[model samples]
Target: MKKLFHIGEYFQEKYSQPLQRIGIDLALGCPHRSNGGFGDGCIFCTEDGARARHLTRVGLNLVEQVACGIEYVKKRYGENVGLIAYFQSFTSTNAPVSRLRELYSLVLSQADFKVVIVSTRPDALPDEVLDYLEELNEKYELFVELGIQSACDRTLQEINRGHDFAAVKNACARLKKRNLKVAGHFILGLPGEDFNDWMYTADQAAALQLDAVKIHQLMVLKNTVLAQRCNQNSNYVKPLNEYDYAAALKSFLQRLPENTLLMRLMGDAPESELISPRWWMKKGQFLSFFKEYFYSDNTQNGNFVLTHTADGTPTLYHPRYRQHFHSLAGAGSEAEKKFAEPSALPERLQKSASEKRPLRLLDIGFGLGGNSFAALAHSEKVSGCALEITALEFDLRTLQAALNLYNPNSKEFNILQELINNGFCRCGNSEIKLLLDDARNTIRKLPEKSFDLLWLDAFSSDVNPELWSQHFFAECFRVMRNDGALLTYSSAPTVRGGLFKAGFTVGETPSFGRKRSGSIAFINMPQEGFVPLSEKEKHIIFDSTAGVPYSDCSLNAAPEKILSQHKKLVERLRRRGVPKWYREKTVKN
Candidate 1:
């Protein structure tokens, strides 16, 4: 898993303790809501513009609001935690420099805050305001949080954002020029936006290389234009579920610079105020979920939970691997598109039937047996040829859990329990031999030139680098027939380079629900219909330091050892200017 930088971690390193954030709403108001600007604020703007709930009394001055917020935080979290004064709500810098100085100074006098953060619109920051904030930061730690909701200008117009992406770019440039820390506040699942649009926002945000970022899933609140629009047209807004939102966030987190601080990852609102997407969890629960899914190795944890994919099929998610047994987009769809069809399982089975022989298949990391079942289903429809499946799995708990999971072919799945009991079984017209062990150990025991189709559907190379190393690929190459094909969903340069090093002709397959294409390798010359590597993939494989493959001489080293060796090799190569060609290629393009 990629390392993420969190604000709590930052505070612990710098201040030696966590900081309890205090939200102070100055009631400066928004320019877009005023008569001089658009006269109507953003569609998602609420009545209070997200004011802190504790500061509820009307006509409270800056000092009073600060006092109320301090009392509220200190009561909830003991007095020992440090405080960070957050100027939240209603375009914090919309007022004049004189008024802003007076409001900002109130929090400075408290002498309890270690840092100050002010949230405002990108268009609200003028040169005069930037100069004043820079001056203020010279004496104290200050951060400017700009609301860069979406990178797509079209979505900005659809939401009546009253600004463009250019404004955000300009504001960040000005802030960075002053050496002030900038944190971007981005929202996913906005109206009239898709996953690609959200990724565009993340990519652009990463390009800016800001000091920190706060990401939130859009929550429709009562009395907001978004809620009314959703009421009028059901399709106006569709909230992301936990799985999809986590998938998007995973991509977002992977793209960010490792040093950038993650201030927030989820949205929060009072139950009474939320109008849609009611799956809000408390901060503790949310952080626990984040750590469990993104941080833990889960090697000792065997709990497997059933989850439904986009194609409405049951799949299992393992906490240890921090990945689902199948793709979240569609478990069954991935089995067909990325595995069966790409490998031509059906066509190969037909050829075997003509020769009066069973088609041989080797399923490595056969979690829930989706790939095998998909191939079997296709072969049954095409012909009556027997399909011989040798499945290698590391965890028996996943296989047991799959027995209770709902699938279209429940009867065939139920027969899989026989494999658990007897290590072999007959399911429909297929012969199944299950090897319950790690693939690295099990693949070596197989005979040479045995399998015709190999499904390398293991966890990602990031987590399971052992399975994708050159030594393991050499074992795969020995077991596979001369005319066989190996297919996997990973398109990482190291995986491809390992295949090449193992003496296989590598190609590509159309990816399913992902940006990068899947990989296809052949022991012999690839067939005429196979797609060659794209230009970008070719460059990565030959020119970049990223193409360096992991090596394990014994083919049974621990994942940590393999990853460490690969990282050291890459660093050594980098110092030798191995990636210079790739850098120059990118620049030329």
Candidate 2:
């Protein structure tokens, strides 16, 4: 596995231990701010001026800020960890040379700090500043981080970044000439830039031979010009999703020099201030993606891209559906919570074992067999239990990707491998029949009243409505025994209504990882474990137009056709006029 040349590794190699940066605000503000106030700062700059959350430099002196920063770091990490004095907030070199000397000398007085880091814009790095930094580098290790947000001059102008690419080039040239270590801060997904533009920026940054680089995602923050623009027109800023950002970051890392240390990969804006691109990924999660990018084959079989869910299990993103194979919260976790527990897998397995019969399961849209494997693993725990699963899947490339991902349950993993390679797999008392075709076609041929439990793990109704239609639910109801229950991760009103329309008792399941609860249905009266929907939920399904389910009597219609028909049905229903009480109640609620 290829490892990232990270700042931590570089620090450990040079200083014998990892160094934690203590961000210190010098209070020397940005020259780009209008009237030298926070209101008209750079479009992306927040009022905090990128200051450390704990340290407010309003009253504290340079020495006092350094002391507070050190205390904060030691309290979080340990007393023995090495420290780096970081002049982080707005242009650190905006002040005169004499003032800079006093502030720099004051912070250097602390014997515990091993290095110094100063962050400023490319335009702010004058020759005098570079000359002084060179003198300081002779005595102690120091790095000058320039805010090179983009390489495209048009994009720089669009973001109100005062400097252009030439400024970055000139700044790097002067810094290198004086033997000063240079670092560049680049942001991906900026306004008016596409994938090629981002690539150009990365290539330009690499050409500078930067000693270190900090890559950030352009985030919309509160009380910024970007936020105001977003309020005016919502689509003005659309951030890259996790998959695209990972691809861009990996490509960016590949273009950088092998020795260039990666200071940071993604941005970490305070949630309270952030307005867009709210990915909410922690440092560790981002690093896991970094490791996955370098080690794993991200683009697999030319059909899917590999990504990790909340529980760190692998899942694939389908380009055609624009959906992931499993929930982002957790693939295995979703399988166990949303399907196994809701369907009462353990109790059913025990009953089947006691009756000396295999528990029959219908796994619909079984992309990668997460639900199947989880069920089999649960069945494995019940000693004498036997399980027979009929898994229906559409894509063959998905099965190929599943074979590549590592699973902890060796038995289940081998079973999936066998099922993919062959048509069926028999291991001990468990059997899985793999049907590689449209679920709508294969489901019609299934024996009636055969399955004891059904796992309806399909994509969202908007993208794959053919599987979630009333007709499909009726087919699932036909196959399930009277006592059998169907469980799905979707709590959409249309899905519950479809189940209700198909002569099944519907209820909500305990929610996991998302706001909406999962849905459970039964052919007859609901089981004791099922919680009935509230009156409002029922009203939306039975009375309101929103509850109207997609209809595909033929069962094998294209998704686009089904979706278009469903939209027309909804429009016609709305045109027919809704009852006043239902309309008011739903609107008020």
Clashes (backbone N, CA, C under 3 Å), per candidate, total 1, 0
Q: Which stretches of candidate 1 lie over 4 Å from their true place?
A: 35-39, 57-59, 280-282, 296-589
lDDT by residue (tens digit), candidate 2, 370-464: 89889888888998999999999988778877776766467656876787789699867888899999999999999999999999998899999
Residue 421 lDDT (model 2): 87
> Can you give the lDDT of residue 244 in candidate 1?
56
lDDT of 1 at 196: 87
Candidate No. with top TM-score? 2
Pairs clashing within candidate 1: 298-320
